[model samples]
Target: MYSPTPSDWREANRKRWDERVPLHLASDYYDLEAFRSGKDPLRDFELAEVGDVTGRSLLHLQCHIGLDTLSWCRHGASRVVGLDFSEPAVDAARDLAAELGLTADQASFVAADVYDAADAVPDTSYDIVYTGVGALCWLPDIQRWAETVAALVAPGGFLYLAEFHPLADILDDETGSRIEYDYFARDAWIEETPGGYADTTTPTVHNRKVEWQHPVGEVITALASAGLRVDFLHEHDTTLFERFGSLELRDGAYQFPVDRPRIPLMYSLKASRAVA
Candidate 1:
């Protein structure tokens, strides 16, 4: 495993993500063939929560490979921009956008870190600012992230975030039957795994990476402090992936077995900046 200084974290993460772009594009989990055939990866809850993007401009932060970003375009977003730190991912998104017959005015991808998004993207603000699941854990500073997210939302617009619940991070990864990690710990959690989440058997070289655990209260408070009002915070018993071995796919979502007690495995929120 690689133990990197704070300054090295972004570079390390970028390398790992960049290397995985091709792997993820080819992975059966992503199923690019199906995607090209008009498969939408945006979860049902995301569609309901971010209702009616028609004629709206959207900016998707940490938008890996831009699947969800373009999906929004498919739903009638007037324009969409997808941003990511990995250049490879950005390139893949642009190619996919072209293949989908979307013009630059309809969909664009930018290669930039999330913290620099305010200056990196084409617009000063968007009708909607969206972040998808598994994005927050990669960020080290929740306050900075909240502030960035807030800045990207246009007046009268809102930010929609869906992520795996931090509570799930505390439990053992194998069975998730016991608490094996500290939810409040601020130190960076570094791990080196052999394969990407999209395909566990695939060989990957840049496996070492850093992650953080931001509690639910901390996230909500940070957003509020950033001048965004919390419209709602809804916790769910289902998650997008098999976060734990104990979870099983049910109705297109991963959850514990029917016989097992339920827990909040994921959460979604809407926070808006008051109309100026």
Candidate 2:
């Protein structure tokens, strides 16, 4: 695990994420009702392209609250396991699993830091290692993250990821029109003052959060170095969530301000081990 300069930064960020869990569950972004009724928030492209997962042992990394993980089980994954760093989220996931009666011999939840507990998870155990949206932005290093992914996969197994595009990160959050941040990797920790993304008025009373950006090339190269062959790299003009300030929801998709029509909003990649 690559240590941050100030160790307190990580703790503070973790706390902030823990506090945001309930809010996210309540937010429209993660509609619990829809999810409970067998609705899959993931786009059709991902569902269609990922193909049949029935009877597969699937591992979900950074599975906040395990909504998507449970969704995978609902979609016929034989065994589904969710791993996350947040204790509150993990607890909530367990409770939801029990309440929904989704618990089975094949479903379980595990909690640990993504970087530190790599060895804790069994090696060559999972047939499919899946990651969801809004996951990669929390890490500090893409190479280390890739190494973690490589360590988790079984021989001949596949790794799948759907994340916000690097180009989307370049837009100005306030105006949402001009490009502000760089496309390549940049290391600058952002500290939001108090309030959370869902409720900006109530101060979170914490201001330390860290995030890292990895470009499309950097991500592809890192995965390839980890011995995962790229099967598909897709850039979509739509997003699964509201990212920019000026974006509008149309026909179940989020789009730009009409001026920047060429930019990609999200990306999904499917990679498999050489043995696969």
Query: What tens digits encode model 1's per-residue C-alpha lDDT throughout 1-276?
Result: 223346788888888998899999999889999999999999998899989999999999999999999999999999999999999999999999999999999999999999999999999999999999999989889999999999989999999999999999999989888998788888888888777779888788898788888999999999999999999999999988888998999898899999999999999999998999
lDDT of 2: 0.79
lDDT of 2 by residue, 184-275 (tens): 64655465667555665555655667777778898899999988899999999998657776778888988876676557888999989867
Candidate 2 has its poorest 10 consecutive residues by lDDT at 1-10
Q: Report the lDDT of model 2 for residue 166.
A: 82
TM-score, each model? 0.97, 0.90
| Off by more than 4 A, model 2 | 1-5, 122-124, 197-202, 257-260
- Which segments of candidate 1 are over 4 A away from where they belong? 1-5
lDDT of each: 0.92, 0.79
Pull out the clashing pairs in model 2: 194-204
